[model samples]
Target: FSLYRSYFGKTSLEYHLQTLENNLTNLVKRNSELENQMAKLIQICQQVEVNTAMHEAKLVEECDELVEIIRQRKQVIAVKIKESKVMKLRKLAQQIANCRQCLERSSALITQAEQSLKENDHARFLQTARNVAERVAMATASSQVLIPDVNLNEAFDNFALDFSREKKILEGLDYLTAPNPPSIREELCTASHDTITVHWTSEDEFSVTSYELQYTIYTGQTNFISLYNSADSWMIVPNIKQNHYTVHGLQSGTRYIFFVKAINQAGSRNSEPARLKTNSQPFKLDPKTAHKKLRLSNDCLTMEKDESSLKKSHTPERFSGTGSYGAAGNVFIDSGCHYWEVLLGASTWYAIGVAYKSAPKNEWSGKNSSSWVFSRCNNNFMVRHDGKEMLVEASLQLRRLGVLLDYDNNSLSFYDAMSSQHIHTFEISFLLPVVPTFMIWNKSVMILSGLPVPDFVEGTSLDHQEQQQQQMGLCRQESPYLTGMKNCH
Candidate 1:
């Protein structure tokens, strides 16, 4: 058993060893297969690693692009917000400007309303009415279709006819409120040297109650003097009843401006002032009252002594002397002022003054007699009147003399016509109208000048001398060289 068991053990041992070898061989084979598989797997893992690295790099690039896009979107949103704010500011400014304009317009209307509230009720009503009228007028004028070629008055008349209702309404209101004032149409006519006829008619004849008349000397003064305020009774003309009343006792050679008014309870309307000038009468030499030796021209203004023309025929009014000849003017001054010029050319002896009719026709003129003489003889100038003698001293070499006689003042004044220098003045009261007398020696020619004398003589000038001389010096009617020559036509 031992031997069999031993041999069995040895066989078993051998079998087991064989099995171990077979198992070892198969294990080796499996280990090799596993190694090969592990190798293949390692190569595959390397390739996968490379692919994974590339994928990671791509993923990083995509992440950077996405971040940039997000940043850009945020910036756009911020810019939109800024623009919206600026638009809001602009809208707010525009709203403020609109509000300011509205405030200004409202302020002006408020001011006008306040001013209107302060006016009187009547004044406010008138202003409102006037404003409405102006507005209506403006609207009507603007509505007109202008035709430049048509007649303006005719077109306006047609236009006015359409709106005549408004005019009638206004007129009715005015008539109810007040009476209409009358208009005076006046005409003035000068009848004589001291008389004027005034004729006037009222536009509304029955509307007048009475008339008021006023006159002025046209003394270059704008103010007028009432006729009732004049000096004498002759000038005190009562307001006459008729329109054909005449104004009498006015001064001659005086310009007068007259005004008349038609009066009523409604109102007084004055007529336009009418101007009238009185007549100026000049005297001429009388041949019937001249000396026989004295000769007179055809015009009766010039008188010269002529020995050959001295015929023996004499009248009662003629002077009986041949040596000293004299002449008198035909006209006599009874009222009003008279001015005349006499040219005494280079005379050794000359006399010029006013004398009464009772004076001696053949005797020389005297101071105590009824004669006022401004005489020059042998370079001696004197004024002889009323037995009074005054030596006249002046620088003027006079060739012509101016004589002014104020009948109301009973005064006579002499002036150097060529130089306008005042010579003398005399106060006299006579019973009758005085005639202008002239006497000359050495055959001196006494010529009456046609030059108009200045109307600047002060009435009854017993005061001023230098002022009168200055006034006369500037009042030369003609040149001194024209003493012997006549006025050229």
Candidate 2:
């Protein structure tokens, strides 16, 4: 029994030892698998690190390339800026050269003009001398031909007196019966496609019984329709009423020529013709004169009733004289001495003369002869003259004349009227004062004080000697210089 028990115990011990061995082997295999898996993870981590390093290096290289590209672009922009600056400098230099050339040409023209004037003066002097010699020779011949018994001195005196009387009569006849019409005074008026206003005055002494207004319309074709002959078209305005007349109900975009004739018991004196361009829109007056009544006619002769209602409402702005403390009182006191004159001419007309009082406090003390003329006012431009009060043809009263810078190129010229010499040219850059009240008059010389003259004439004059020297230098560089004298021996 003892031997069998011991053998069973030994078998059980052997079985337990085998079970422990098997469990150890399984634990070892599991540990080996875990070690392999850790090794694989480590390898993957190393590969990832290598890849990250490569990517970082590549990114750095690309960043360096981008920086270089940016630097190159900046340099290119800088170069373009410099090139643009150089181009502008070149253009400025060209402009300077052109101005210099123009100045030289003008100088040459002035020289030529001066020479021509000198020649004309010399010719006139020679003609005067010849006429004086002829008169002396004729007088001497008449004395020599006289006989003793004929009372030669008396006869000669009588003949001379008769000749003088005949000459005076001929001159008078020429003055009275001149074929040419008197100068017409033109006033600009607002005229549109639908309506027009005509204003005129006559300087002649003839009694005007009626005024005949004539107009011609162009139909855009070869034929022009004359309104003068048409009975319905003629307007026989009595001279007892106002001088101004308005014509309305005309086609748009049409050009019309207008004229006036004064008819009386003796005869009819025809006035010079003027032109007006019509617009489709209604006529409008300048805001300054909007309150003034403007005439309108439904037919050329028949007046319209509702013309005043169509005008836009406007209030006159109060005139504020220069801020001088006593200016307002001075203007009022000198108002009587100031006189306004309107000149009408073909193609342009304006109010010209403003004579002021000499004394500020005296009723008629200040007398300053300052002229304020405007060719354009409101929308109306001076087209032609009829008599007095310029004939204006426009859509509205331009009132441009009252504007500071409203200067007519021809009207503002500073010329010696008696000598017909050009003294200066002025570009109007300031508003013109109203006639009569605005001028600071000096009666002694009949000139206005502080009136703006031409810019070139103000202050110091151009130093022609220095300018010529500078011009010579520039001309030599820019253009071929020619010697003034020829060297032919």
Candidate 3:
């Protein structure tokens, strides 16, 4: 039993020593953690001290600036008051001198009159009295003329130091903060073919000293933040004083993103971006490229087949052939998207399309490799490219034809303007600049350019797969009358 007690005591002592060692380790770990926390707290205190000093210095500097401004204004006002006092004193001294001179003249005149009264002899007295009376009359008139006019306005009533508004402003002075961002007035903005007038409004306009306008072409970029961060693509117009600005020489038929910044000495804030788009470029039919047998009227926008050939100088660009009666537009399109409409007024036979600048002018458009056209010969409608004609479904009574040329996207689409129906689209890989081409065998056709793309047209457009399907369907069967127009043209 004694031996058992000794062994148990020894085990208890060992357990106590292990527990003590664990407690010591825990205490050391806790103490180390407290020391680390204290060091961090010390660092925070030092940072706080430095920040407090920096803010204090900034406060003193701002106060000194305010004081200096007040001192300068006070000095200016004091100088002005001194100048006013000097002017008043000088005028008052001049008036006093004039009064003294007038008084002395009156006294002299009175003395002369008294001497005249002293004369006793009748004739001498009469002569002396007459002379004295004349002298007195002259002296009175002279004194009236020499008297200085006293103006009540010279009391400095008009010169006022009304600094009540300024005092209120000074009292309201505080730390200035960045102005609130401007809001783009999208509805108020206007755009032309080559210019965009951006209008904006600011909530804190009084605090803003100037405005900055930043803009860039919007090329289907959904992430505006990334687009704006690209500094090289942006165009900035700084120090704009007015709420509106007009930017000229912009690309026609293009979309742009704009931001206005309200800036001041305190700081600046940018407005939310606004998207604006310019209209399609305005173009007229080129009379210079018209066939000699064709008649152009209505500012060269309407073309008609003329039986009598008109007198015109023939150039290499003019359409000159037996059956190739065609005309090209005035402008060449190489970039951007454009939309124009052709008014087919009582025209049964017509071809509307685009052609390369180097396209043969003396040949029927769409019969060569350089042009693509949507043509209607009598009741048959077809799209022809590179001498290959494909039949397409179109309304027989279609009056207006819409053409959309997306040069960058390499697309040429035709639409039924009245019904907003998609007629056809050509996916061409254009390697050269192209111009609008028109050919008519009967009646007249008019063009309307510089029009915005219609909403229905945008929504009704087919996707890539659908477009490919439609293209394949249109090309599935070649037109049997392809050789028929060979003799007609």
Candidate 4:
């Protein structure tokens, strides 16, 4: 029994030892794997450290290169600034040198100006000093005339002439001599007329005894006649008649040249010759073939034989409006009717006769409707109902049946062949003023001295007879001289 037990115990001890050996081998294997992993981790750490160091060194090298470039650029900028400063200093020095040279030139010019002023020649000195001062002012920006003021005044005093004294001397020289010839002025009435008026002013020292007038007429044929006359000292020629001596028997259609010579006791002066052509007379109406109402008088006045005879005469009904007229003897006056009514049933055209007269000195000739001669004086205006007006002068003699007013200022003026005066003023504003005997025609109202149409009639239609009647009524009511009558022609 003791021997068997000892054997079992020995086996058990061997198994335990085997198990311990297996566990020790597993530990050794695990520790070897741990060491290999640690070695790989260490190698990775070293590579990371080396790479970090290389990157840091590269960054440092790049920073040093950038710093070096910045230093070089800063050095180049500083050098450029120093060069600009040097150039500015040089320019300032050159400008200073130019100013010094200008000052020297100006000083020399001033010296020359002073030398010119020392001489007595004032004009030359003024010219030289002006030039020098202008140049100096331009060069040095200064204004200084080098001449002394006292010296310039003295030079002017020495050279200036006494103008007032010289004028007195001239006046004294003319005191003893004979006065100048009398001044004469001559003027013609018109270009184609024979009348001549002269005006003269005699010198205070001389007296004129007699005056003479001379003239010549050309007859187109080689024949020429010269006429002369002597008269007492007078301002106007006395008894000056037309076509008497100056243009005696002159042909109607011929042009003539005439001259006037004025003579005094001292001497005579011929005036400039004037050239003129006489107007030929119009064709005359024969007495045998003339109309029935027209009768020729010895004094060239055509008289109407009978007013009632004309009313029954059966002449062709011709339309006569403003300014149209018949033969000389027939004269018509408006009876203050409207122009349209007078022109009713009539064509566009018509005619009438006009007779005008100035203020008559003789007894009023009660031949026409009324004998109150209306005068258009220089300052006064003659107004008509048919919008016509006229201006008159002294002694305007209008002949019966001599003037014809057709329209507006269109009128036949009877310029007296003997007197050369415009004898009549006619109005043709609306209708012609002519004899109503031969035919029923339009006639114009003779506007006597009164207010203008615009002043009295205020309407669009100026020729309205109603407006004219209203105006005439008002005028008659206001004026004492204007007699309201239906027969005022």
* TM-score against native, each model: 0.47, 0.22, 0.69, 0.22
Candidate No. with top lDDT? 3
Assess each prediction's global lDDT (C-alpha) against the native: 0.64, 0.39, 0.86, 0.37
lDDT of 4 by residue, 1-489 (tens): 778878878888888888888888888998999999999999999999997798678767866886797589779877876686676566656555665665676578868877977968888878888887777667545322332112222222343334597557545532122223444433333322223233444443233334433333443333333222322211233233221133344333234454433344335444444444443222222233223433434443232333233422333332122222223222233322111111112122122223332211121121133121232222232333222222234233322112222222232222222233333333234343432221111222121111111211112233444443454454333233333422222
* lDDT score, candidate 2, position 126: 70
Lowest summed lDDT over 10 consecutive residues: which window, candidate 4? 447-456
Error of 3 at 330 (Å): 2.0
User: What's the TM for model 4?
Assistant: 0.22
User: Per-residue CA lDDT of candidate 1, range 336-450, in tens?
Assistant: 5667787777666777888888777766564346878887766767666544445576443678788877676566788876666677766566679888888877556655532
Better of 2 and 4 by lDDT: 2
True lDDT of residue 280, candidate 3:
85
Superposed Cα RMSD, model 4:
49.8
Candidate order, lDDT descending: 3, 1, 2, 4
What tens digits encode model 3's per-residue C-alpha lDDT throughout 302-387? 99999797677889999987666778899998887789999998998889999999888887788788999999988888887777
| Each model's total of backbone clashes | 3, 40, 0, 23
Candidate 3: 10-residue stretch with minimal lDDT: 460-469
lDDT of 2: 0.39
After superposition, the stretches of candidate 1 with alpha carbons farther than 4 Å from their true spots are 1-259, 262-280, 310-312, 386-388, 443-455, 459-462, 465-489
Per-residue C-alpha lDDT of model 2 across residues 353-450, encoded as one tens digit per residue: 22222313121111112222222322333211111112223323221111111122212222222232332222223233322222111110011221
